[model samples]
Each structure stands twice: as C-alpha cells, then as structure tokens.
Target: MEKERGYNMQIPEIQITKSWRKSISMSFDTQGVLQVRAPKFMLSGQIDNFLLKNSAWIDKNFQKITQRIKNKKKYLLWRELQNLETISDLEQYFKQEAKKYIIPRCNELAQKYWFTHAWIRITSAATRWGSCSSKKTLNFSYRLVMSPVECIDYVIIHELCHLRQMNHSTKFWKEVFSIMPSYKIYENHLKNEGWKYTL
Candidate 1:
C-alpha cells in the first residue's frame, strides 16, 4: 500500500518518519522518494503547517523526483531480469563482449586517431571505466560493452588521448575534444547509465 501524508495544501507523495530529533527536516533520497523526518512529539498540525510552508518548493521539484524514481525502478527491473548471478558470470560476459566489440573498436579508433599504446587489458573493475598507465598500457572495464557505442568511443578516445598527455590537464581534454567534439554528451550518458551494467 502507498503511504501518504495529509496537509492543508496538496503536497506530492511523501513518506514521513517520526524521529527523536528536536526539529523537522526533509530530503529527497537517491531513489527520489521524498522523506520527511519529524520530531516524535510534534503534533500533526505542526507537520501539516510545515508542509504547507514548503509546498511551493516541493511542487517545483516533484515532477523531477517522481520521474527519477520511475526511471530507477525501471532500470532495477531490467537489471534483475538479466540473471547475472555471479562475479565470474559477469566477468566472462564482459570479457567476451570486450573482445568481440571493444577490441575491434579500439583498433579502429587507434588507427583513426593515430594513437599508440603498450598493451590493452580488459578488467572487471567497478570504480573506473578505463585508465591509461604511464607505460602506455591501457586498462578498460568489460561492463563498458553495455553502454552505447558513442560512450564506448568516448572512453577509447579519452584514454587514447592520454598517450600524448598522461594527466587530465587542459592538453589532455584538448586531445579528447579534437577527436570527439561532443564528448560531454557521451560522458554524461556514461555517468547516468553506466551503473545499469553492473551485476
């Protein structure tokens, strides 16, 4: 059943939790659920008044929060359906995907951008999508295969640029932009959707 709070003004969906704290507070969780934490001793009217006072702000952010929650639930269901049960399953899946798609694409981009590297290694790292060592060796995440080709290309170009400038100085970004004019678009895509590839 859906939990709701009643107030003088019609506020969006919210879940209220009673706490021992002295004051009332509110926030949107990562899943975009609006949560209100109120003093356990506070009266219902006081809470309603507080909600009324902040109704405008709530209304302003309501649509965005609800949409975020919907998108999160949708992705959760999609990921669950994949049945990726073990680390080895995820690793093997991504490794084969990297060999089939990432390696060939990397070769194509390297040729197009005239970049060189010592070696390429596909990894099961969760923290980073890719990295370039000072030794010119390249490391990539196998899960990257789940992202769009544009994001994959961005990661490739991003690391390949490191062949010239190892650090993320203006020169490094300049190298990335030279090959991918709209790199930020794909960059943001990876940031928003990359976690969906996880096991």
Candidate 2:
C-alpha cells in the first residue's frame, strides 16, 4: 500500500510505501521528495515516530539536494545545454568536446610526465571523474569537459599517476604532487563544483 502524509514544515510531504519488508528505510527522490518504505504491518503512528527520530538526517540530506538543484540551475554548461532538443544531442556534444580536448591534453601530459598507458576511454560516468584499470586503460567521464582546464589537467595527471601507483597510497600522492604541486586546489574545485557537471 502507498499513501502520502504531511510531516512538518521542513519536510512538507513524505510518500510512504508499505510492503512485506521487515525493516523500514528512507531516502529522497530526485525531486527531493522524501520516500519511506516500511513493513506492511507497521502502524502509521510507528512510522511517524520513526520519521521524528530521523528528522535531523532528513533535514541535512534535503538541504544538500536543494543546493544541488539550485547550483545546476546556475551552471553555465547546464544552461547552455537547454538549447539542445534531446539528451542524445547533449551527449554527442560532450563526446565531441571530450575527444577534442581531453584526448590531446591527456597525451600531452603523459609525454610531459613520462607516463605511459595502454589506452584512454571517455565515458558518461556521473559518480566519478576518472578511473584506471588494471589493464592500464584509463577511463574518464565526458562530463569532465565541464570543469576548468586546470581541473581537467588534474584529473588527467591523477589517472596518469595511477599507471605508476594503482592504489592511492602515500606513494601515489607523491607521484601526483611531483607533477602538479597545486593538485589539491584542483581536487577541491572538483569536489566543490563537480555536481554542476552532470547532464
């Protein structure tokens, strides 16, 4: 069964779904709507108490989602993408730009740093900027083009360093620092602003 209930001013409405599940779980939807899943036999009062107990967690996550939505609205690339008629067009544009910029830049950095890799691949990953496989193949998100050039170089260097140190051990950081002394600045920039890189 499913029903919507008003919780409080901060949370507004919560969509509750009851099923044969033995435990209760909660999460926020893409639109920032709170969703609760509870055992079918649980009472509404019990659910209310559960929500009250977790109000702090709800408030914190809700604020994060709200801020992410606001930032996306203000994102320059996201705004520019509004002119595209379809998601496919937007993805194609990202691929074209990533190939044009990232591939050449990666090659230039690899030569400058004396790093060699098997191959590089661009993907549509949303959760991470780049990855290096055990096979020496490097994978980067096409969304990385949305970042500043320095941030793009940081990611490239990071992945190239991975060819030497696959793990993020102290030695890996040393390799990174050797190439880009100010890598932390670009790292933090991506951490703070990477959310805006999504489609």
Candidate 3:
C-alpha cells in the first residue's frame, strides 16, 4: 500500500510493503519511487517512526536523483548529443571546441584583466571547471565552452585571479570583482544550470 507524508510543505509519496524480512529497510529506486519494506508483523507506528527518523536522508537523496534526471534530460536535448555516439566523439568535440573557443577567450580576458599566466590547457574534467597551479599554469575543462560567454569569462577571470591569490579569501574576491562586476550572476548560473552541459 502507499501513503503520502509532508515535510516542510513538500510531500513525497512513499510505498510500504510488508514482507518476511526481519527489519525495516528504506530505499529509493531508479523510477524515483521511495520504498519502505517492513517485517510482516511490524506495526505501522514503528514504520512511521523509522521514516520520520530518516526523513532528512530521504529528502536529500531524493532531490539528488530528481536533479540528476533533470540534468540528463537537458543534456540529451543538446544537438551535440545526437551526433555523439561514443566517448571518443565527445572527447574530440570538446578538444576542438576548447581550442577554438576557450583558449582564445582566456587570452582575451587575461589581457583585459592585465593578468599574466604561464599557460592555459583544456581538460575533460567532469566536476571541476577550472584550476590554477602554483606555477601559474591554468587548466580548464572543455565543458566550459558549453556555458554562456559571461559564465566562461567568469571562470577564466576566477582562475587568473588565483595567479595572485591562491586561496578564496576576501582579497581573491576583490580581484575577481575588479574584473567582472556581475560575476555572481554567472557563477550562480553555473551552480544551478551548468549541469546541462555534461555528457
């Protein structure tokens, strides 16, 4: 049988099944269903208590899966996904696009910001969009090209600013703000919607 529970005004449907199993177990499945399995003899009060105790965990994992599916759908909608049948095709596309776009854009921003770096290289990193090393060399993900021009410039300026300040402190932010006044808008975009660019 199934029931609904509301937490913080968000109601997540839960399905409960009684089985021969000895203990209560909670799980989430690929179809975005939350399931609670209980011993056939267990009381509903015990089951409700178990779910209540783990509500936070359920909320967190459920949101993660929901967002992941949304992102996958967004990624699939991109025209590039249609032609990309293999991993190598995706890699080659990123490399070529990075060379054509990311490198030249970084060069332009570095000049505008009066920043100097040893060099910049493009990568295929899935998580980190960019990084700067102690040696002043900058590495950026090819996926960055998939972002808006504002977001792309934000990432570049962020890494170049690291050339002066290695850590994310007030001084580092001052450097970034000096270049892009509205960077937070693009930064938030990267945090919220940037997952659409992933393969």
**Pick by TM-score: which candidate is best?**
1
Worst 10 residues of 1 by lDDT: 3-12
**Candidate 1 local lDDT, 61-111, one digit each (tens):** 776676666777777676568755434576687789887888888888998
lDDT of 3 by residue, 96-171 (tens): 8888998888888888778899888998888988999999999999898878888988999999999999999999
- Model 1 TM-score on a 0 to 1 scale: 0.77
Assess every candidate by TM-score: 0.77, 0.72, 0.73
lDDT of 1: 0.83
Which scores better on TM-score, 1 or 3?
A: 1
Better of 2 and 3 by lDDT: 2
Determine which window of 10 residues in candidate 3 has minimal summed lDDT.
2-11
lDDT by candidate, in order shown: 0.83, 0.88, 0.85
Whose lDDT is greatest here?
2
Tens digit of per-residue lDDT, candidate 2, span 164-191: 9989999999999988999999999899
